[model samples]
Target: MFKYVIQLILGFLTLLMSTAISWYEGSGIIDNPLEWKYSTPFSQIFNIEISSGQDISQLDYFVYAAKFQPFFPTIMTVSVLYICTVLIFFIFQLNRQLAIILSGIISCVFIVMSAIFFNSSTVGGNIFFWITAVGALIFISMGISLWYRKKYMFKFQPQ
Candidate 1:
């Protein structure tokens, strides 16, 4: 019971940090107008100057940039992944095999979602991006560690 509670608390903490960092990174792009050109959702939110004499309308820019932008999609996917992982942890508490499988699914989804940012030149260097990735990894590590202990490391006390 104690171990389960500890694991649950830690898992929640990891997810919370991941979600917070993802949002932080997403919001940081708006700090610079030029950076917003790479994010359609952000472009739609704010008008950005392209050059000394030229400016782009958010809608017009979004129409051109939407097909290539992954920033918003990654944030949404990670949020959903966080919710699903938390549910898996709570619902599969008694089934180690089920928990492990679900954790793998959750980890894979996060990996793919995170992969969306690899091609992004701006996102790769953001501190919040690294923090978010680390937080998600911690969540996966906690789940795997719990599953391993339950499957192979259980101890029996002498009577």
Candidate 2:
């Protein structure tokens, strides 16, 4: 029971961390030793963009700035969330599974909302948003399925 609780907390944290994915757009790159930008000031100082083509397309530049930490935050958050999500599937209690499944639904809702704007947005924004949104949507769908199995598809008897 305690393990399940810990796993549930981790799962919730993962959901919260998922928002970090938004940070990738503004991920800054470096040109020369003196020339660089980053999602954060610290990233720029420690991370160097050595790519020959230092300039992103005008559209990509705008989108990247609009986002941030592409190389860091987004991946980190989603990764944490995914890890917790997997734990939730294998270990959480039925009631907690309900919350996790609901969270997945919420993620799906977020993606749908994003899709509405992505259609009218820039090419880069459109692509990134759609892919991430879809990923979130799929995760939620899978979670919901797992929850369904835990709830209605199985019967638990006391030992």
Candidate 3:
């Protein structure tokens, strides 16, 4: 339990730091005309024309950073995923079966996310694709190892 708390705190701190850095990097688009084109994913997707920096939503700043400069945004994404994974593991630690099921579900979700970015032409898309693909592999491996350890490593003795 103590370890879980520590992990959660560390994850949260990482998330906060990454978010701040990403936000700062993203906000640079407001001053750089060259970045305006790279920051238009939100506008393109939502069909909203952003003629000026003032028209960009706060959330779009994150998207801008993610699209042009993926490093900090990637860290932010990984941090959030880590926090969620830790919480899920802590919640279902006592129930191996449930944990395994949840792990599989999470892995599938990651797989889908990876696929979504698989064909993206942007640097962020490539980074996200790899991140999600690796995440799927990690979750699936965790689920498999847990199942194997529970089924093969433990012998039940009748009382």
Candidate 4:
């Protein structure tokens, strides 16, 4: 009974973590002008400059850039991939600690970096692009390790 209870708790926690991760992601953020006012600890983490006169509408969150843009999308993609991969492992009932540790690591990096740049009080601060980029790099590192282990293992996926 105790073991089952622990498993249940673990599963729920994992799901909750996944849910939170999903929420901050691109699909999660409800492109609201209000989200612009979040004044978070990681506010000024992203530094974007408005082009000469490009009138940016609220719905333009998917924008890459006006002057130097490709960087933002590339970083955001990392967050998506990291969270999606973690979700996949979770759904498969793989190692819970592995998933949690990996996810936490990603989360921590963003949190720390975000705190350092907190409260930019600028238009670009509304977008949390740096966190996303850092997240992707972290994910890529873990993914590579998993891939190498699988490729070299004589007996992968131990039962």
Q: Which ten residues in a row have the lowest lDDT in candidate 1?
A: 61-70
Q: Give the poorly placed runs of model 1, Cα more than 4 Å off.
A: 1-82, 123-132
Q: lDDT: which candidate is best?
A: 3
How well is each residue in 1-159 modelled by candidate 2, as lDDT tens digits? 676567667756654554443433343432223323322344344454435434433233333543433433344445554655555555444566665665676577657756654764445445456656766776677777776766776477655
* Candidate 4 least-lDDT 10 residues: 61-70
lDDT of 1: 0.53
lDDT of 1 by residue, 75-148 (tens): 54445555565666665666767777777666665565456534545533242345346546855886778687
Question: Residue-wise lDDT of candidate 3 within 13-124, one digit each (tens)?
Answer: 9999999999998886777667666666676677767777776666778877887899999999799779868976786667878888888988999999899789888989
Residue 9 CA error for candidate 3 (Å)? 0.7
Worst 10 residues of 3 by lDDT: 150-159
lDDT of 4 by residue, 1-159 (tens): 454456556655555654444333422223333333342212234443333222223233333121123344434444355445546355324654465456556656666645644564433443444554455456556555555554566575578
| CA lDDT, candidate 2, residue 146 | 70
lDDT of 3 at 100: 81
Q: Which residue pairs in candidate 3 have backbone atoms (N, alpha carbon, C) closer than 3 angstroms, thus clashing? A: none
TM-score of 2: 0.42
Stretches off by above 4 angstroms in model 3 are 32-38, 44-47, 150-153, 156-159
Each prediction's whole-model lDDT (CA): 0.53, 0.51, 0.84, 0.44
Instruction: In angstroms, give how far residue 41 of model 1 lies from its true place.
Output: 11
What are the TM-scores, per candidate, against the unseen true structure? 0.44, 0.42, 0.80, 0.30
Q: How many backbone clashes does candidate 2 have?
A: 8
